[model samples]
Target: MLMFASSRVGSVSAGRISNWIGHRYTIVVASTIFLLGSVLMGYAHAYAVLMAGRCIAGVGVDFSLMIAPVYSPKISSPSSRGFLTSLPELCISFGILLGYISNYLFGKLSLKLGWRLMLGIATVPSLALALGVHRMPESPRWLVMQGRL
Candidate 1:
């Protein structure tokens, strides 16, 4: 529930963030935040810290969700826009599937490490995204809007 609420708030504010920083950077930022949350959750010794990590991760999720739909269209050619726009949803489904599988596999470990492994594993992907996003082109539309082009 806390995650849900935080995501809603993040979704509401993501447009402003995207406008200010551009979609590419927004994704990088979101991924970084997600990474932080994952690390926090993985190492958390207290309930409050765990919930806080969850909320932070929720915000990152919402930011990615909000930006991807808008960003995809801007980056795609008209002919490919429909297909590209669907990729985010598909990727999300894939991630969820992976998460379930990992949870099951990790659950076999000792209780102290099982959940931590499950949560901490997310940081790998988040770190990848944060590092890789810089190689991608910024949205042309966003660039134009920002008067950078």
Candidate 2:
């Protein structure tokens, strides 16, 4: 899980060797794939499918986990940067909390669909995150670097 985050986060930093071609797009695409893969993994009955889904999800997780810290500070003001830096840790805890709550709830359902439901539940957040990104502004630092500021 940590390694997956590393990959996602790492991409958000400098990106890739061929990123000069379209790194930002690649990261977004990869993130989407990861999110979808995670949801898919939960429902996957076959071991191979589950593993593949996990791997894809890991890639996407890597993209988001790595990207935030890599770019957040560059755009944050010094006065509030410390708080901003803590957001990732907070997010991690929140995610874990949510997962535990959800798993506990699903575990009580006493049905096959219950397990699947728990895994598929992640799709909602992934969709929300994707939409939120589309609605929000690009990084101010990135804009400034591009001379849009």
Candidate 3:
């Protein structure tokens, strides 16, 4: 029962994540799926109710990934910065792995903490990154020397 719920959220999260970051239409589609899932979860009953939670959880996962790569270049520099910029996606993959590990190892946490916490954890880094991004300058930068000093 719980396993079904835990996995429900992870199922479609990948495809939605892929789509959401790529284009405007993708976001609309993702949002629609997310909204549908939220509605389903809210009023769910039977095994199917858990299923909707899964769907909602999956879309939440997508939301976590939606803006990650795009946030990279805007935060990084020209040389070696792309590597640093890649950290967002890198960390995302790592978090997925960690979540998998958690699910496998922490059965108690899964039952007690619930799937929502896992989804929230996945979102926190991205949310923090987004908040940090707002403080950044939206400008192209270069190393320049104005005077010999």
Candidate 4:
């Protein structure tokens, strides 16, 4: 519930953050936060720690979710805007499918190790996004908004 609740709050506030810091920075920040949360959850030994990690990861999830569609259209060519904008949702659905598969595979492992591995695996994509964001161009609209265009 904390995850869903935090996502609602984060989704609501994401636009303000992107407006202030721009899309690239927002994505990097979101991924970094998620990476931290994943690490915390993977290592968490207490219920409180697990909940805190879930809340943090939730915020990160929503921030990225809100910004990606908005950013995609800005960065792509006009001809590809629709397709590009849809990619985020497609990727999310794919990720969910992968999660289900991973859950099934991990479910066979010892209980403690299985859960931690599932949570810890999330850090891979978050870390990848954090590192890879530096290579992505900033949204042209955002650059205009910042007077950097």
Return the number of clashes found in candidate 4: 0
RMSD of each: 1.2, 3.9, 9.8, 1.2
Each prediction's number of clashing residue pairs: 0, 6, 1, 0
Give, for candidate 2, the lowest lDDT window spanning 10 residues.
Answer: 17-26
The predicted structure with the larger lDDT, 2 or 4, is 4
Clash pairs detected, candidate 4: none
lDDT of 2 by residue, 31-105 (tens): 577677877777798877777776677667666665666555655789989888888889889999999999999
> What is the C-alpha lDDT profile of model 3 across 1-149, one tens digit per residue?
65455444444454444443332333344445555554455445556675755656565445545544543564466785779677867886897789888656555564544544543343444344435545554322211121222
TM-score per model over all chains:
0.94, 0.75, 0.44, 0.94
Tens digits of per-residue lDDT for model 1, 19-115: 9999999999889888989999999999999999999998888888898788888888999999999998999899999999999999999999999
- Give the per-residue Cα lDDT of candidate 2 at 33: 71
Better by TM-score, candidate 4 or 3: 4
Q: Residue 111 in candidate 4 has what lDDT?
A: 99
lDDT of 3: 0.50
TM-score of 4: 0.94
**How well does candidate 2 score on lDDT at residue 69?**
63
lDDT digits (tens) for residues 1-149 of candidate 4: 66788878879988999999999999998998889889999999999999899999988898898898888898889899889988998999999999999989999999989999999899999999999989999988888888986
Q: How far out, in Å, is residue 66 in model 3?
A: 4.1
lDDT of 2 at 49: 77
Arrange candidates by TM-score, highest first: which order? 1, 4, 2, 3
